[model samples]
Target: MPTITTADGTEIYYQDHGQGRPVVLSHGWPLCSDAWEHELKVLADHGYRAIAHDRRGHGRSTRTSAGHDMDTYAADLATLVEALDLTDLAVVGHSTGGGEVVRYAARHGAGRVTKVVTAGAVPPVMLQSPANPEGTPIEAFDGIRAGVLADRSQFYQDLAVPFFGANREGSTVSQGQRDDFWRQGMLAGLQAAYDCVKVFSETDFTEDLKALDVPILIAHGDDDQIVPIAAAAYRAIDLVRLGTLRVYPGAPHGIVGAYQEAFLADVLEFLAD
Candidate 1:
């Protein structure tokens, strides 16, 4: 369980394995480094240095009461990469983790990073405004916050339903997958989890997308119920200077876990390019 102390003194837990080029992974909201277990093994086995870290208040990382915003999330990731002296890094982020990588590239530039992959991620923006009318309503995000405050445990359990597409008519995910999602969500700090709802839904990454220099692959599920394709990856692809959009037909927000083989193969192919 290797950990790095951020400038703010938060103990960020990370996993570094294998050798060769580094493939850094950032997990989704309320999830941790463990969320990338499938991707990690594949990357490591394929001769890539796989690295995944628990965001500030998730997983085995220290549960701080503050800095649960995108700026801090990106900074923490930057600190980890810098500390490890990793070069030509291929940053892959899922859901909220996508926002983290986009912000990192925008804020820090792509001197060390070579490419990026955002899978089932939130970027550009998720919330509706006068400018971006296609965004999800603020009330929808408010409902998420209300759900978290009401019962953190049950809220996470309920979220796992659609998260893994279990609510669909012909879901490919198993009960164990939903249970695993619940376990990871419950492990996150209550405050950080609640705060992240705002971070993921409200934070704008439009400028970040515009600032991207390195090649970026925007991956999303066409059937994703959590982050709609039309509002997320579709719009994100148009913003990046060097971007490619790949849709996983009939996949869910948790596609990385549900469609592990395809997801890994798609990413490996993108990294090879």
Candidate 2:
């Protein structure tokens, strides 16, 4: 497996496919690069160099006990970009990956970036506070931490229901899809997976979003149960200087796979702009 060694010596695993302008993918929590497999194939076929990496402590990457926070996550991604010398890039992130992209663009600067896309992303903020009334309560995140510690396997199984909208009436989400979620969750490092709940839920990206100057596509499902649209994508777009919104009605949190065709089309169109 191909990998890059971060400044901290953490080995980050990655996949590179096709050949053209680069499109780097950042995946969500408790999941790895495999989550973006279909998107990569489609992107490569559409004439773009599609790449993805397993965030440190997830998938094939080193399962280090430290640096599970957002700052380090963005730095690791920055290392990947510099190592590959990718330029005029389009960075696409999903869920937790979305927040990473926001921080990356803000912290490292977008001098080499051309465009950005986030799907069902957690940003602006996810934790309830005086500034964010629409956000979820801290007790809810505490419940997630408990779930991770008490029964990760069962927790992942149950999370897949809402993550992919498998529980919704007339939903076409397959048993395999839910099983896939569990499989991915099981592959992640326990420490990293547990620590990520706080990273995604509590980290405020208001300043980061405001710092991005490149065009951004903020896509969110109206019915996303994990990260509500009102608090995440809705507020995120407002914070970014140049942001566009794509509302997926009746879509779940996993809109990328649930609405693959539409999502891909929207992404390609935005990239071509």
Candidate 3:
């Protein structure tokens, strides 16, 4: 049970495996580091120092009510990096974690981060606004918040469909995958999970993207239902200083697992470059 205490005294549980250039993984909303089991094992087997942590109120970490925003999420990650003295890093983030990595580089500086991968990440803003008229509407996020409060169990069960494209024609998403997703969602604190909806949706990462200096690999499934490509990864590549795009045709937001081999190969290749 390896852990680190945040400035606010929240204990974050993390996994550190293998030994080589550190590759820290940041996960998405309502998911803990275990969601990254495949990646952790694979990256380590490939000869990299793989690491992941349970964000506050998610997984085995402190279920605190406050500090569920992107700033705090990034700060917590910083705490882990500094505590471990990790350097020359390759950081990977998914969904809301995508916003976290962007914020992390911007706020703490990318001097140590050598490379970054954001798969199915949310960035450059996900909310609908006058300037970003093509974004998802506020009501959709509100509905999410409402779902968390109303019936989170059922909501998670239902959400696994769109999140993983389980309902898509000829989809291979398994019942175990959906059940595991539900299990992870249930572990999160109700308050933290509820608060994160706003963090992922409303928190604009436009300036954060502009501020990041490291070379980033922007990977996303073309048909991602959670974070649309046009509003997220597609537009995010244009905003970053140096970015490469890898689009998975007809894949869903969970492409990292859904297309595991391809995603792993792509990440390893980018990190090696």
Find the candidate with the highest lDDT and give its number.
2
For model 3, residues 1-273, the per-residue Cα lDDT tens digits are 999999999999999999999999998888999888999998999899999999999999999998988999999999999999999998899998888888887887467787888989989889989888879999999999999999999999989899998878978888898898899999999999999999999898888888778899999998899999999987898898989999988889875454767888989899988
Span of ten consecutive residues with least summed lDDT in model 2: 254-263
Count clashing pairs, candidate 3.
0
Q: TM-score for each prediction?
A: 0.97, 0.98, 0.98
Which residue pairs show collisions in model 2?
Answer: none
**True lDDT of residue 2, candidate 3:** 99
lDDT score for candidate 1 against the true structure: 0.89
Q: Which window of ten consecutive residues has the lowest lDDT sum in model 3?
A: 254-263
Which pairs of residues have clashing backbones in candidate 1? none
Over 231-270, each residue of candidate 2 has an lDDT whose tens digit, in order, gives 9988888888889999988889885455867888999999
Local error of candidate 3 at 260, Å? 2.1
Could you give the C-alpha RMSD of every candidate to the true structure, in order shown? 1.1, 0.9, 1.0
* Clashes by residue pair, model 3: none
Arranged by lDDT, best first: 2, 3, 1
RMSD of 3: 1.0
